[model samples]
Target: MGAPELMRVSVFKRYLDELAPLDESDPHQLPPSLLQDLRRFKEHGRHTEPLEVLAASMRHLRNVAMHLQDGERVLPLTLFPRQCLAHCPLSLHELLQLPLDNLQVLHVEPAVLRPPGDPQRGLVKALHLYHPLPLLSWEFAMRGSREQLLPEIAGYAAYRASAVLDLRPLPIPTPLRNCVRRLQRETTSLRQLSEWPGLDRAVASRLLNALYLQAGLIVSRSHPAADTDGWF
Candidate 1:
């Protein structure tokens, strides 16, 4: 059928819940004992002798839940630069220092604001920046290892300059088309996919399929196609 009805957040959540473990080992899964302990810790007084240890254990459990929850919550594919940054705070410098594999998504506000100097190393797989400052001149880093930067920069700029720029995917340029394709192949979740610019319904559908297939979230009826060339 035409792009299997856009998968809903609830569906994705259900998938996540199924895959996650119910204990301290898996944030998605919670063991009965751990759950009981967490509840007890929350209810007990702070001055109790065992309170410190219990609170520490609870904190660790909460962290795991928070991480898994972060993975489960999918932001809209068309998130603005400011929104992304606000949701996931990290300075460009701090982000650059992170291992490439560790960098999930980079959200830039006014994605159009290019960092000074030519783009260098330490580019993440997905980037989202805002565009168009009224006073500042809008410029894109057209050349670099991080080529995706240009479109992300440009898309934000175009959006800010005028309201007319179509954020939806409808005959997008080859560069962005290729970028979306790469993201589809490399990323594993919708949360990861939402980091890029210009992801419309078509792109989102393809990405959901890729993630489901790659993660074994869905079983294939027949031999899975080796090539997914034109889905974008």
Candidate 2:
């Protein structure tokens, strides 16, 4: 399976600390009502094209970040994974690392993205964002720590897969301006990202995936710089 070329990290030094993206506080600390957006989203949305499917879910994440504070919704923007430990040993983290050919994204309710076998109702179930913090911590412990990207960026990447490549939100502690600048400047796919001075395919993929979750990516199959990685 070939993947589409992913855009590099969309970091801009100017906006690094100037604009606070979203509250880095725990997700559960927000409000109980917030989960309803995720719940309803998980309950519906089934599309085939990677971009189309991603938009369906990411719309809510964007809402979560920018619409949060003062009951306005942070929508500064985002999105998570786990709980399949019952019948399947593959954590959502592991599934994401698999090449796109191996990854399976099923559109089902009860909030399981792509499942080989649905776990029994009473069992551990999927990454139910109804209560997100527990699983976030659990996944962190299970996956260990990764300094490859910023805390915010890494957290976002943990849940995202395919994206067209976009940018960082704002006011991040340590914005990867180099990465962000590259993507913002041109339209490139995952395969084409190798042209960057220091980015390997793996790092490029990780960065693109992270951007996708943060709503920092864009999909364009027609750009002269764009080419499918066949991983889609």
Candidate 3:
């Protein structure tokens, strides 16, 4: 006998429900207001799911969904997807090679971080930033300062223990390559990473920013038992 489709779909369904900003009596449906918020979240890049703030927000939405009365013909939020724990360097490397105009295309309908309850599926989510990557790269490469692009790294020392580094084999600069290899030994903090022998703290910060801008770096997964280190 075949497994029921719901069994195959339960995980995905659970994902959508968690991503919804509001709750519906149906559990599977989202309200128009929540849908509008998601659009704003996409434009502003506030759609990460691995942070407690977002989880809290979704919980709030679920509370709202629970009180809904009527239904609409609006599309399900599932049409716009997201990826979690992406292999960003290789992805960026390939993307950087594309033409500027092509890079301007918005590839992901919209992607966000995965919530806490999901299994540790390896690099399974489709990248939502693929479309905006090229443009972001250009902006980051040209006018972007490290501080402007990423301010969270300054406070990263506190939660480095929760950070996971899943690296892809790519030709990165020697110093950065060494840092990634060292992270594989154990979970590391920004403070600790700053003290590596012969590696400049600035270099480490640069590497982190580079990987992050490309969506290569994986932040700590949010868990009530464990600190999520606040999604950067």
Cα deviation at 193, candidate 2, in Å, is: 1.3
Better of 1 and 2 by lDDT: 2
lDDT of 1 by residue, 144-163 (tens): 11212111111111111122
Clashing residue pairs in candidate 3 are: 21-61, 22-61, 22-62, 23-61, 23-62, 23-65, 24-65, 49-113, 82-111, 107-131
Leading candidate by TM-score: 2
Task: Tell me the tens digit of each residue's lDDT in model 2 across 1-232.
Answer: 2332322223222334465554535463333344343344345452222222233334433222111111211111122233212112334443234333322222212232232343554533344222332232222222322213222222212222234432232222233446556567666656666556666765565556445444455656455655545322
TM-score of 1: 0.17
TM-scores of all candidate predictions against the true structure = 0.17, 0.32, 0.31
After superposition, the stretches of candidate 3 with alpha carbons farther than 4 Å from their true spots are 1-144, 147-149, 156-170, 214-232
Model 2 ranges with Cα > 4 A deviation: 1-175
Model 3, 29-141: lDDT tens digits are 54445555435435666432211112222323332111100121111121111322222222444434433221211112222333223474552344532333223332333
lDDT of 3: 0.36
| Ranked candidates (TM-score, high to low) | 2, 3, 1
Clashes of each: 17, 38, 10
